[model samples]
Target chain A: MKRALRLRPKGLEKGRPETKPTNDAERRQLMTAEGEVRGELRRLRARLPQVTGALAASADGLVLASETDEAKEAEHVAALTAAALGVALRLTEATGQGGFRELLIRGESGYVATYAAGPTAVLTLLAEPRINVGRLHLEARRSGARIGELIRGALERPALVPRKPNRPPSLAGP
Target chain B: MANTETALKEATTAIEGAVGAALVDYTSGMALGTIGGGKDLDLNVAAAGNTDVVRAKVRTMELLGMQDEIEDILITLGTQYHLIRLLKGRNHSGLFLYLALDKQRANLAMARHQLKRIEADLEV
Candidate 1:
């Protein structure tokens, strides 16, 4: 945000509270971005009744906004989502399956699905056991992308640019 | 598709000079299935020990910000070859196939070739 706002002079370091959007207009803008993301989650629920709950978090797993009944558990869910993400990213890379786009995990009781909202955010959905997975994916992917945009807007971050995939420099590095 | 039991059996029985083989879940360091290890080889111990090797490599990749995944790792000793092949695809994430062979009698190239073939058919 500090970078995006250009409030601080060049070479100014971190830890300045003034860098935050403290002005009323700036704060409203940030809230609106957050509101839009949460709204998208709700709209997704209405479209796909199978989606019981959903939350959008940063890639590091900090919850930006959520629309889930299990409010108290949201923290743990985001943390675990991040952990699962680490494994999923590695799993995809290891398989030469390209970059991770989404992940689906089905338990006997229900499904825990996650999608890449953007380069820096993730969308995780909790669904009932009887949910239509295909429909869920269809709806969630769009919502994930929308939420990613809102998040990037709120944070004033630039869009993700695909980078050239680089192979490991050497296997003997360790 | 190959099940754990049959896969272990095949790797041990078919891979020339293979003393032991195990389908290891590296996340838990548990040998889900094992075959052909006696007191000298200790497939269970090898499975757990090799988990460290896999983990170290994974961490190194992260630190280096590498965009590639490991296909397999080979370690050579005076009289043995330790092969650890990471399972690919969605279903078998966090799992690896471990095989121990008598280096003197085992053909490293052929061993890798056979491992790749078996890995393709392995379902778990």
Candidate 2:
């Protein structure tokens, strides 16, 4: 079940081969950060009467942590958030808007919301249609900021590693 | 049953001074169908870009604690009126209909009414 829940960044795999080797370690750090964010999400859900679920995901659509029972649904939401983020960023830039902030979709059953978490991640929440939008935004914006910091820290840690000199090409071909 | 492509075509022809119309998936930022766009206005780009406007308004509503559903979002340029109508049907979730109209020749109220009618007849 855990394996099934691992979020894969299918959209970015093609251009990021160099980041592969450190994936395991980076994933560990991210998971730790995610754990903290998950705790925050849980608290937010507990305080808000209408929130049904919450998730933190990377900008590329990898799920960091989720506070929902339906893992598959969370995965799909995260991917969609990433896709939405792409267009949102472009829209803001093109229109002279400051930055990509948040997105909300209202349906007959409920509301789906996404907030920018720093530069590296996003926070998505699902809520009952009757939920208080003001309170949801207040708590969510705070939580999203913290999660963003955590993720940004995790991403920056890897940069501190000492770089090894490029190896000389082997003279003999096997 | 009416389909997305037919509905878009009908939107451009039925609405006066319509430059283009499109069915867009806000989730994927992709246009499912488009009609009537040319060199000055690109329906695909407009469709994709408007997803943000829809998203921003929704977020603002959440922040403002407003509970009312959005009927439609209207953007008026010097020569154009961009109308975005969110699809409320079960299967049409996350999708919206976007129509760009020439301001001089289009009747805003009637265009909105027609778009609403078109939205009801649209099948995904």
Candidate 3:
């Protein structure tokens, strides 16, 4: 029973790479996976020069993958982004707005935009002034839908921890 | 707003000295659109500046651990009233439509009701 409630399976193997694709096959697989889902962020980048980075993160703020050096800080960004997402989600529910779609952040140097990627993940982008923001937004929205499909696929997998059978009660115990 | 154009136009005309009427997103400080911003009042600057107001208010609510949502935020100037209404619809989260009206000509009750109507129709 304790095992069933645990978040992840206990460790038995350790040789696998911690992150990212390491070879051509894996890279090709990832690209194909995204492409299959119609995740075409590359085209968006071509149209928007200021959109320097794009990434997808889990609802818990775990960085899935990103195009920038900020991958190392993805967790932190994800967490804060999740907080904002939570607020946005709730606001939509409370107001009868239909559904929460996206979030936007603007600063002097750049803009950070996030969109809902299915139920369990988010797609985020960092854009500067050089790009056509409107075009970037259009592309990002399409990519967000594809990312949502990817996330949904990941979420459909069985839980890592297995459940245990119920134990019979002991007569002697008080 | 379900009838943003009508409400905005009415607000501007009815109020004796309304400088502007705008629907702004507090999170990004972007005006979805605006009406009545004159040379003296820049709606863009107002939108950006008001982001700080929304942020500070939200931060304060967090510090106090308040679970209630902000219904409306009123900023009172000597001659002006800056009214911020947080949208309730799922379509417009992290956004509040703001209206600036002159203190003398505007009726607060009518303004609030009209603003609510406008919020209902805003496309976001």
Candidate 4:
């Protein structure tokens, strides 16, 4: 019999924290951009008949937005995407295949696909088995590019504040 | 129902010119079971490496807005054919079967047919 091993790599759940905006203006701008991203995801789902779920996550596995009803499943899928992305990036680099593009996995019942939305985020979709592959790619690519821009723009905003360092207690004199 | 290991071994024996076969979890990039790999072809490494291929294709499909199920992924080389068959069924999600065959002795069509049968019978 084939051995089934359940393995979870170290630090797989350690997603990078989003940058904190320095002031109210920056925070408002970031919020607006995030709202736009969510709207785009919703439209993508609405336009695609076979798409059962859609999620946007950071490269480190943090879930930013999800259209699925199952929040837990979305979280798990995001983490898995991050892990798979690591391997995909390395494979492309080692084989001189240029940059990572996308990934698709098909099963008897449905399909799961991951797209590199931008330099820092990934977009994943779940769809039915009978969905049209060509259409899925066409719409997803356009939406992914748009999402990438929104996310990258938010990340590049100059109003982010550096995290404060912890201070040790003074022991020299009381 | 046949187990994954039995199914893997059966695949190697039933398919002509098969050098190695493995059951891999693309989510974790780990091989659940393997048979018939040596110095020239390491089943573990192949299984892990192929996870990336499966992932890349899935990503491409999403980006292109193509909604379709992948039946199998075939990679052809000078002397070898790498076949990746994604598993279906509720219990078999997130898994795939990887088969490597010597191009000279294997019939691609027949091999794919046999692998499909094995995949159907495989019990996760």
Comparison by TM-score, 1 against 2, better one? 2
Candidates 2 and 4: which is better by DockQ? Answer: 4
lDDT of 2: 0.76
The whole-model C-alpha lDDT of candidate 3 against the native structure comes to: 0.63
User: What is the CA-based DockQ of model 3?
Assistant: 0.04
Flag the better candidate by TM-score, 2 or 4. 2
Query: Model 3 segments beyond 4 Å from truth?
Result: A1-174, B1-7, B14-17
lDDT of 2 at A30: 69
Ranking by lDDT: 4, 2, 1, 3
lDDT of 4 by residue, A1-174 (tens): 111111122243246222211344533434446677888899999988679999887666767788887999999999998788778766765786765668889988999998877655678999997665655766787788888788657655554455433211111111
Among all windows of 10 consecutive residues in model 2 chain A, the one with the lowest summed lDDT is A165-174
Candidate 1, residues A1-174, lDDT tens digits: the string is: 111101123244245432232333433433456678888988998986767888887555667678898777777899899788868766766786765688899898889999987666678999887565545666777788787678666655322333333221110111
Candidate 1 C-alpha lDDT tens digits along B1-124 = 8888888888887889899888887764667889988999777667766776887899899999999999999898999998999999999898899999998899899999999888899987
Better of 1 and 4 by DockQ: 4
- Deviating ranges (above 4 Å) for candidate 1: A1-32, A157-174, B1-124
Docking model 3 quality class:
incorrect
Clashing pairs in 2: none
Q: lDDT for every model?
A: 0.74, 0.76, 0.63, 0.77
Top candidate, metric DockQ: 3
